[model samples]
Target chain A: MSMTMTQKILADHAGLKEVSAGQLIEAKLDVVMANDITGPMALPIFKQMADHVFDKDKVVLVPDHFTPNKDMKSAENSKAIREFSREQCLTHYMEQGKCGVEHAILPEQGIVVAGECIIGADSHTCTYGALGAFSTGVGTTDIATGMATGELWFKVPSAIKFVLKGELQPYVSGKDVILHIIGRIGVDGALYKSMEFTGDGVASLTMDDRFTICNMAIEAGAKNGIFPVDEITREYMQKHSKKVYKEYQADEDAEYDEVIEIDLSKITPTVAFPHLPGNAHTMEEINESEKIYIDQVVIGSCTNGRLSDLRKAAQILKGKKVADTVRVMVIPATQKIFVECIREGLAEIFVEAGCAFNTPSCGPCMGGHMGVMAKGEKCVSTTNRNFVGRMGDTEALIYLASPEVAAASAIAGYIADPRKAGN
Target chain B: MKAKGTVLKYGDNVDTDVIIPARYLNSFDAKELASHAMVDIDPTFTQRLKPGDIMVAGKNFGCGSSREHAPLALKTAGVSCVIAQSFARIFYRNSLNIGFAILECPEAAKDIDEGDQVEVDFDAGVIKNLTKDKKYQAQPFPEFLQKMIQANGLVNYVNQKREGKL
Candidate 1:
């Protein structure tokens, strides 16, 4: 069988002679990560079972989700995680501004790389797949095992090809592309397969764009999403990582279990409905729905909180203040991004437009802290996942859209198209 | 570490929230987690699971959250081993770190059913599903890993290391 770059990496590292689609193969693991929040509980379990401290080098810890705790409970949770990190002698524990978010920090620190199998105590661990590794998120127990034993099991999954052929239109960021894909393939469409993203349109995107696209692959229930290292990848790696990376590309004759072609040009700026990424809609289509009153409009997360996303939201919100009734919050994915937004004056633009920006944490992504909407309140968000009560009350509603839509919605205090405000 | 147990079947995408929901993230007690294992998905996984029942899941088992309560819940609930087609990354590692036998039988999930008496040989990297009378391949534990497993978990392993037996 023709093998794609990802397949080859998984197969070769799995210690098997050769692997085909849907074949079960277990591979050796190279890296493992956990954050302060998850690591606290997980380390105790690890301590209960294993006699050794975690291999200091193989483990990484970041305090990203709740950088600025709003209350004492969260503060205690953060404190526990810090104490656990110190006790375990974990070498890498990122601070608020030093490094931010588990996913971006690991890669930025050269901890995540190609041909590695990494298990993090976070769900978005699949973000590393963009660099050619087989990576996925898991519960806290799993991170403990990887750190303790340095191994993980994997059933070779069938590949689903997402072939993109057209360029994205103006104001349409990579987040929109993923939202469009989610719309086409509901939330659980790729439940047990690797969603391999390829095609000409992929060449047009940068590394950050690819990361944003792949970061949300798990939302579609994909085992992982990947784009082979290209010039764009090389450029990003050269600037950030000093280590060498082995990149993979799908073979020309590689066979995919299923193929879905997408014309990026055909996709309009879209939104995911109240409880799933799979439910997608264009602004025009959404205009027909009952008016959506948003209590909050957020623009950040592993999904859509980047310099580009911030810039776009700033562009749309510049000079136009958000409605008094709407509360807008932005969480930069990492410290670098927060720095960039400030450096480029996008931070000012957003703040000037009534959008409050927070540090690089997953504050509102889990609905735990930061901007939790009230019962029956509605929110438009850019982060992944809009499950019932995901970011607020169970009775609260959520609409997932690109940063542009979120910004526009903040101004109008209801779901409105950014294009309509084309002042 | 080697363990023998009965097979307990589960379907796909058994997430962490199902194992131990977000609401129960507080507290680090093992028994506390075990009591809530699979409460969200089955609400009976804990009560129904026998002391030596080994859990086997189809694919994407433990797919959400980094909650450590999952494996702790499974271990405390009396699951002996977990053999799955695939695991969400974190759960796989967590299971091992906590000393629960996680046998990587990528195909065993598809082959075995509920209530199959299985023998998991960590040193040999194979699972004998006695009920099905089939022996499925599993990744053998390396020498270092065997020591870690025998010690029961990471903390135990560290203790053993401190004793200079590692």
Candidate 2:
């Protein structure tokens, strides 16, 4: 039987010839991950199951959420994960000075590669799907179980094929593409299903773009989002990974529950308004309406805080000054990206533009700390999820947009179109 | 398995962030987490919630994050079971892994109102609204899920399997 890419990977991991949608099977895991928030919760349960993890090398832990010690509780949370990693003798544990966001650093460190079955306690673990891996987020207990057994049960998910046809417009990136798609399909559009990106347009997106797209797959309620392995993927793996990797391709006759065609050229700079990632509006739509002003602009997160994202924001903010009314925070995803930003002079550009360039952290994306908005405040952010009170005050409003739009909005002190801002 | 409770109704996409906001994620204390359950969306949720209360909501409930804290918060806050038109996959899996009961029934979610009393029969997949005198059938759990629930949760099920008792 013809099988989709996800099905093929699942079957291979499960040591079966074939697996179909909704078929429950026990598959070996290539990696099991947990962050500070979830890691602490999983440790006690993990201890209950076994004295040691299934494999020290395979169980990865990162304390990114409240790292740099936000408060007494957050400090304690990070301390638990640190102590557990030492006790377990885990090879992949990432500490504060060396760690970035879990999703961003894992790939950069080459710990996750194509055709592997991976699970992380953080929802954005789906980000690894950009490498053509079958990855999904799970609860702390699942993480604990995977760490103990090196295997977990999964119901093979049916897939929705997104055939991308054209090249994206200028100033439009993967953030816009995902925002546009989520806008078209409500938040639950791909619930419990694999969102497989295919077609010629896939080659047009950069690795950073693909990462941005896949990172927010959870926002669309997808089991995972994947891009087919290509030259770009191979080159990325070659550069960062030393481990041998496998690649899987979908059968031409692979079954998909539904097929949605996306014209990439038609996708413009888009933004998801306050309250939901699915509440999207294109730059064109926002321009036609009343000006939506803001109090802050955050240009970073696991979603869009990669090197390219920093460059995109810097390109728009290069010589421009942020509006006096708006406070802009630029956070690079990882320490490597942070150093590169400084090397590339992007940090200077941000500082010159009056933006606060902070250390690598998840920061304000989940409202853990740094750049928290006040009540009645509004922020234009490049992060994923605009759910109520996500950033800070329950009354604060968050507008999710691309880094370009975020920079432009900061300059204009309102939600402004990136395409129009620089020019 | 059965549960009966008063209903606390909500609308579509009642996300995990709102169910238990990120700000309070530092502490793993059950009671502290429960104290802030649904604080973002409904500040008085803990005050309004009582033991054996049934929470009902529209489509795509628990729509964000993989935080088990969300379900743990609701369960500890005394929500007996959650009935929704649909649920986000991670949240669905998390709820079951923790042995927090949840049912999906569009009709029941749509017709159920706040202050109504409802009872659920997990084995029979029935949801009866005692206040409205109406009944709705929920989507039954799959065999594996039913087994997991029977074993109390994923951890227990794993333990049982290791002991060759599953």
lDDT per residue as tens, model 1, A121-201: 777888888776778776665566567766654556778898989888777778788888878886556766788888898
Each candidate's lDDT (Cα)? 0.75, 0.93
| Shift in Å, residue A356, candidate 1 | 1.9
Q: In model 1, what lDDT does residue A394 have?
A: 60
Model 1 iRMS = 4.5
Give candidate 1 regions above 4 Å deviation.
A22-24, A48-55, A69-77, A80-89, B1-26, B30-166
lDDT (C-alpha) at residue B12 in model 2:
97
TM-score of each: 0.78, 0.99
Chain A TM-score, cand. 1 = 0.94
* Sequence-dependent TM-score of model 1: 0.78
- At residue A249, candidate 2 shows an lDDT of 96
Least accurate 10 contiguous residues by lDDT in model 2 chain A: A414-423
Best by lDDT: 2
lDDT by residue for model 2 (B30-125), tens = 889999999988989999888999999999999889999999999999999999999999999999999999999999999999999999999999
Instruction: Give the top-scoring candidate (TM-score).
Output: 2
Model 2, range A189-220, lDDT digits (tens) per residue? 99999999999999999999999999988888
